[model samples]
Target: MWYSISNLLGFGADFGPTTAAGRLLTIGFWMLSLILIATYTAQLTSFLTLKASKSTITGIDDIKNNKVPHSRIGIVIGTSAEEYFLKTISQGSTNYYHLSTTQDIFIKLLDNSIDVAVASGASAIYAINNLYCKLTLVGEPFYATSIAIDLPRVWQYKQSLDVQILQLTESGELERISAKYFNTLTCGSSSSDESSSKKMEVQSLAGLFLTYACVSVIAILLHLWLKLKRHL
Candidate 1:
C-alpha cells in the first residue's frame, strides 16, 4: 500500500523487507502496480481517441428536450420518422430538416448538418452495421409498432397465415432470421485492429496474485514463529 501510493505520487518509497517472503511479495506488488497503471493508461488513451464527443445526442428524448437544436434533427420526408417527429416531437410544426433519402440522413450527420436522424430501428441498424461504420446506434427505439401484412377483407387463408406466423415465432425461427440480418457486425467491431489491442485481464495477473498470497502467508507464519520464540 505504502509503496504503491508513494510510487504513483512520485515520492521515493524506502520499503526494506526484513524477510525473504516479504521481499518476494514486494516484487509481486511492484509488477501488479505496473500492470494496473499500464492497463489504466491504455484504456484512457483508447477512450480519448476512439469514443464520440459529449455533444452526441443519445436518443429521441434528447432531441425532444432540445439537447440538440430541432433544426438539426433530420427525418426522411415520407418516413414514419417524420410523422413521429411532427406528431410527437414537433407537435404538427415542421421544425425539422426534411431529408429525401436515408443516405442523406447519414451524409448530413457526418457533414455536421444534422445532429439527430430519426429513422426506423431496423433500417438504421442495417445502415450503421453495413454502410456507416462511424455512425452507431445510441438509444432504444422511439416506439415499437407491430408489423402486419395487409390481407383482403374476405381472404380464406388469413387464419392459416396467422397460424404459420405464430408457429414460426414460437419455434424461435423468426428471431433467428431477424438476428441473421440485423445482428451481423461489420463496422467498428471489437475485432478491428485498433479495438483488438491487448489490455490487462485478471487472468493475466493470476499467477502473480497467487505467488503474492503464498508469500503473505509465509511472512505471517514467520512473524508468528519469531514472536513465540521471543515470548519463550
Candidate 2:
C-alpha cells in the first residue's frame, strides 16, 4: 500500500493500490505532499534571500576568526566588556579603540570608524533600541555579570534596600524594565515592512493548486475506469 501510494505520487515505486482504502490514502498523500513541498520551497527561497543581505557576523567565534582588525573593534573604557576583551580576546594587548561612552560606540560605527563594539548587554541593547536603530548585537554574551548597586560601608537601610530589590525582582518588575529596553531592539517592524512589500497573494499559489486539482481529477477518472473494467 505504501509503495502504491508512493508510486501514485510520481515516486517511481512501480506499484498500484489493490484496495479502495489504499487508493483514497494515496490521493490524500499526494495532496499533503504538494502542499508541504510548495510551502517549503517558497519559505526557503525567502530565507536565503534575507540571509544574504544580513550581517555575516553571528557570534564571537566569527569575530575571533575574522580578527576584524584590532583598531576597528571599539570598547568603552572602564567597563566589564572592555576588561573581558582585553584579558581573554586580545590577551592583554591594547588593540581595541577606547571610547569614552557607550553612545560613542554607535556613532563611530555609523561613521565607519569602528567595525564592531563590545559593551554590557543591557547598555548595548538599550543603545541599539533607543539611540541607534541601525546597529545590532552580533553574538552571545561572552562575559556574563550580575549588576549590583554599590553601597557605602556606613550606609543605613541596607536591609531595607535589599528587601525592596528582592520584592521588585520577585514581582517581575525588573524583568519588565529590562524587556522594555531589549524588546524594542528587535527588527520586528522591519520584518513587517518587508512582508507588506512582498505580500503573497492567492495568485502566487494558483498554479500549484491548479496542478494538484488536475492530478486529482485524472486519478479519479482512472479509478472509475478500472472499476468499470472489473465489472465488465
Alpha carbon deviation, residue 222, candidate 1 (Å): 34
135-216, model 2: which lDDT tens digit per residue? 7666667778777788998778998998999999999999999788766645544344332336466898787668766766
Q: Rate residue 35 of model 1 by lDDT.
A: 68
lDDT at 101, model 1: 86
**lDDT for each of the candidates?**
0.75, 0.74
TM-score list, all predictions = 0.58, 0.59
Compose the digit string of candidate 1's lDDT tens values, residues 51-101.
544336666788878887778888899777777788887889987888988
Alpha-carbon deviation at 35 in model 1, angstroms: 15
Q: Give candidate 1 regions above 4 Å deviation.
A: 1-47, 50-55, 151-159, 188-232
Worst 10 residues of 2 by lDDT: 188-197
TM accuracy, model 2: 0.59
